[model samples]
Target chain A: MYRQKYLFLLPGLLVLVAIILFPLLFTIRVSFSSWDVYNPGLNWIGGENYGRLWEDARYWQALGRLTLLSVTTVLIQYVLGFALALMVWRDLAARRLFRVLFLIPMMTTPVVMSVLWRTIFHESLGPLNPILESLGIGAAPWLSSAGWAFAAVVMVEVWQWTPFMFLLLLAGLLSLPNEPYLAAKIDGAGPVRTFFSVTFPMLGAISVGAILIRLIEASKIMETVYVLTSGGPGTSTETSSYYIYIRGMRDFQIGYSAALSLTYLIIMIVALTVIAKLLVRALVKDAA
Target chain B: MLKITDLELLVGSVAHLAAINASFQPGTLTTILGRTGAGKTTLMRAIAGLIAPDRGQILLDGTGWTRLPPWKRPVAMVTQQFINYPHLNVRDNVAFPLVRAGVAKADAAARAEAALARVGLAAMVDRRPSALSGGQQQRVAIARALVKKAPVLLLDEPFVNLDYNLREAFRKDLVDLLAVETGTVVLYASTDPREALQMGDQIVLLADGRIVQSGSPRDVFANPASLTAASVVNDPPINPIPFHQNGVADFGALGQQAITLPSGAYTLGLRASDIRAGGPHQARVTLTEVTGSETLTHLSLNGLDLVMQEKSVVLRSPGDVVGVHLDLHKGLVFGADGQRAGV
Candidate 1:
């Protein structure tokens, strides 16, 4: 007899299948077919789209670019976030106001934040270049030039996402016991030594967690690139997600985009798994 | 010698430590005896430089440590909670202080190892603090404190969290371990009076953020400065009775006694041991408790609650009337102001 108790799980199971499993299964099936604007039906063309994307230099180049952009941005975010979190963790005047102000960027919608950043990056008419010029630093082309444009994208990512890291690290800091700090103080450790010996090491597992979450979110960089650089002055700011968006939506290559997406998903899973192992080994002592 | 003069600390109008004047000579372990929330921790924290005193000075061998940060002060403290570094192993946890104080890692490790062995935790040196038992973790904390060998060692009820057997055993081990450090001026805080009397070279009685008495353990015990101090230092708690005097002091159902004194009002503090079974007066047993080999029986005599202690275990149920003898000579007497008075 079928257990009547399992009927209760059906609603939740159905929702999971509809929201998650179905799309993933459908995308996998669609990847093997050659579907496009003209060839709208799911006509089988086994592995042809995958074969083409493997040789496509643009896809690989975009993957490499995405890797550089996310890693650099996430690392910068981690450092800046940790510094900010520590600054407001204790004994600061107007601490609550500062905490709220620090989280404002993360609280904003990503597309809106990107648009605001894009306006700031406007070379001739923006507030940023004028301020930089006023500070005796020569103004470079922000959105027009490749290097500055990439920098601008990285800047936006860091400014918008650093709060997530800060929040996690600060929570970790708050939960820490007062005894270790007391012990450190009695041990005659200065502030810097205490940070390295006690605070930083104590926040290790949380650091890894914040970094991983940021990295995963950062790897799928789309809205900021779409608004600011549009992958360009010659594809310099084009990330993997943006490239996939173009292939799927702009050019209408459904089968090819599906293949690209599945590849990206698999690569992210494998890469993140390896990265997690390496990070846990380095940060957490028990894993070592 | 470590001296504290007129040290006062107020936490927003509540006096945490008020006018606390005390001193400790080298090698003497003075137990700051008090009940919980009696400013024992506040006083110790002030000495450790964790909290600043609002008034007066803390001088350790002519060095003013009132404004100095805890890290800059030459001190080591073990708290009531068994706190050890969660990230570090037992060995590293012990060696951390020495290493941070500019000692070489290898030298610190060797010393830490020796200290661990002294605390009977030699086998668990490589294990993390989380992996150890509560007693073991506390021993690690003690080992860490000892490894520092700082001149001023403040132990704030270090074995409070342990079980009875572990606490008893750890106290003996601590005494043995601490005996070797002859130059170290150790200050131990304990709420238990018996522990204070047993462990302290001297006892400083604290009540309501004030030092009620300070003397040798026997001196403090023999002459309690205040009724509050007397009651605090008594085990099974002292029975405090207020007497209305009119050439005779009221003793409730134990009967009034004519005393050679002229008094308006006075309080008599009596221990459970002062009341013996078999006498002219009778008290009804309200409750009976057997702790170890002794029996503590609660009684109601003429609408007054009293306690009688027996050396042997005797189970007397509720409503059972028993004849009790009042040992007046052993009972402590106090004035209306709670100050101890001569019988």
Candidate 2:
């Protein structure tokens, strides 16, 4: 029986080994070698690249920003998403229309949205600054100031990703049995009490799952930030992906770039493993 | 303590309903009887505050509840789907309302245990809903509703999905348990005639969203107000034989007899159990099903398929040429316009 089951899964196993396993192994091997674009030859550098990465201030700053972005984005998305889901759920009159409207931003291409936001925050002739100016308020440079630029990137990232969280959490909310809510209501529970006691506890699994998925996506987000800020304003908004791109493609330092990529990959693996363990715990508790 | 008056509801512009005014005396079990889509569920939902009527008034102890939201109505409902929280253990699911009411953890636990013990699920407190049998899950739902202590309980076909024996036991237990709560009013809905007759003290018969009749179960079942109510409130049905009034009901095969007519063309309604076999009336047996205890015999009698439920030792074979008899005094007669005739 086990053999038969394995036979059925042979195609998937082959695909995984070919696409994922092989590439990962190849990348790890390349990370340890000094094979720059100039010299199309590999010189075993051992732990030299690893040692350099530890002292790289730019890499550490980029890593820190990415961490901050991932944490802040996940937190914001979870709250905003859950709130939106609750609102949509309670307001049955416009639920379908609101769901479709919320999903529009998520469906739009990230690159395209980034371009649109770029125009809107263009320091002058942009919609936001002019609106502020019109309101008798001083207009601040949105993407030009380093501090403002980082904030803008975080805000835009949250906006594009909030809908993803909402859709996921909404599915969880909608799929929940309506009985608990009714029971709570019958017990004379006010709306707020019912939500905390019934809705939030029941949705823990879905909330964790949504956050983990958004966290993974946040760590890999590239196209939007690349197009919007280009990791400029003294690399204040620079993420790991942009830093890797700057080393490999712009500076032609493939060896250093490959080392950085490997480091990021390890960080991701550790983060995902921790998150997966927590998710499993949450799911098990829910199941129990 | 609950009264529903002048309730009218429309379902998404597709169906319209106008349920009759009904009241439940404290601690009384009022059974709502109807066919599918007869607005039984809609009426229950309206009372539970799950559905808003385009026009109506609901009163709990004479207080207007129509304007109150579901949370304020003090009503608990167990739907046909058996509403229990799947993620929570049986204990937590039962204690859900208590916990929400700000009962301390230990107190809530004690209450949950008591409710579970009442439902005979105390040993399975930690079990999830999926692990429980259909009947067990239903008990958990009941336990949860019981723990809520709502004065008005609206149950929509709570026993619809349970096996016959379990259904009977749970129905009995539920009626008995709810009976002890003097201030609570239970409105139970069912499409089953047997259940309605056995469990209902006061029965409301509905057809096409209108209350055809409302009275004691005995009265509604034995002397229904209309042909629809007669058919709906009896298992094996109070069989109706069409006949032109001619100032008498013509039971074609049983021979013509002068029967009193209230008004309009009338039909004779005979209870299947009241019918007897081996008479002069000639008819062919269309179907015969022996269900261990009794044999249900059907015949093509005067263009209507007449059913006779009898405790016969020997089951009659289908396609048998048989003679049937009717106890006319035991059956009702309905007028052509569907109203009860002669009473």
Candidate 3:
């Protein structure tokens, strides 16, 4: 029976090797060698590309910005998403309608959403400036200024992805055993007390899982920054992925880009691994 | 006293409860007996202030409780599903109510320990609910309710999820614990008649959203007001046969004794134990079920079927004719409307 199961898995294993392992091995090979389209030659350069990457200021800046973006966006998304999920989950009226409405932003393609937001944040022609002017606020550069550009990119990203967090957290909230809430109520616990004591603790594993997933996705954020800012205004909104794109596609430095990409991949793996460990610890603690 | 007067609740165009009136005294365990979908839980939830009744009111010691929310009421509930905070240990789970009530940590811990010890769960105070057995989890739930010191405790089939042996053991422990809880009005709901008889000081029988009868368990058992109430409290089911008068009370082959009853169409309710075997009246044995300690012999006579409880050592089989005698004095007589008629 075990051998039959293994035989059944052979086709899936072959597909995984072809689609995942092959490219991963190729990327590692390319990261070690000085290979570019212009040279059309593969010359092994040991760790020179990686050594240069350590001294690269722009690369370090992009990494810092990516970290900042991931942390800030994930935090904001979690708070807003959790609040929205609580609202719809608690409301008995029009709950389904509100849930569907809240999921619309996530349903739209991210690149298309970014393009749509680009027009909305247009400095002079956008509707947002006119609305702000109507509200007695002066017109400010939304996508032109360095700080405002970064804020605008973060806003778009948060707006588009917060719904994913909402969906996940809402499902977690719904699947929670209802008896505890009733017990809390009969125990004379107020709403806030029940939330902290009963709701929050019960949602531990789900919250960690949601944060981990959102962290991984938000770390690789590129399309919104690319479409809206294109790393413009002195690289203020450039992320690691955008920087890698610039090095490989624009500068034709494939070897250096591959090394940067590999290092970024390693950082993501480590971060995700830590998050997984935390999740396991939480679940084990719950069991214990 | 907790007085429920003319309580009516509508659940999505269906009447869940209608004109339920009962007064529960302090220091008493009132068991609500009903079948599934019989609105037993609805009545308990109304008393807990978890759900609002559409009409009527619940008053505790002359104060109206219909408008109060569950959190404001001095009530605690243990549901059938043993609901424990999976992330918290037994101590914290039991102490949560005290902490929420703004008690000091040291005081809450002490009280939680006392309550856990009351439920025999003090040894497992540091273990999470997931680590404990189902019975232990329910004990934690009970301890959580007990620590709240709520005057009104609602237990909705608290031991329905446990195994038979565990249920029996926990039932005894619960009875002993509640016996000392003076001034607490506990309302327990169960579909099991034997459980109600075992745990209830007072029994309220419900059927189809209305109270069929309410009295002491022995009184309700000895003299059920209606056929529904009789069935609600009878195990192995009461054998009901249509009774007709022809110048004398005739109960088919289960021969009836002399009794003065009014001339009208009625039904007779006989408990299995009241039907005596080995008499002049004859009934063909159709089936014999042998339990460890007792045997339930199913018999049929003149198109009426009846069951008789005998010792397990008795030898009986299908298609055998046997003499049966029904002790009519121990049976109940119901009118055409299924209400117990006066003799």
User: Native-contact fraction for each model?
Assistant: 0.79, 0.62, 0.81
TM-score of chain B of 3: 0.91
Q: lDDT of candidate 3 vs native?
A: 0.88
Best by DockQ: 1
Docking class of 2: acceptable
RMSD of each: 3.2, 3.9, 3.5
Q: What ordering of candidates by DockQ runs from best to worst?
A: 1, 3, 2
> Model 2: runs farther than 4 Å from truth?
A1-23, A33-41, A81-116, A166-206, A249-253, A279-288, B10-19, B219-228, B241-253, B256-267, B333-343
Clashing pairs in 3: none
Task: Give Cα distance to truth, residue A113, candidate 2, Å.
Answer: 4.4
Where does candidate 3 stray beyond 4 Å? A1-48, A90-98, A275-288, B12-14, B241-256, B286-292, B311-320, B335-339
Q: Scored by Cα lDDT, where does model 1 land?
A: 0.90
Segments of candidate 1 deviating more than 4 angstroms: A2-55, B237-269, B302-305, B332-337, B340-343
Model 2's number of clashes is: 0
The 10-residue segment with the lowest total lDDT in model 1 chain A:
A279-288
For TM-score, the strongest prediction is: 1
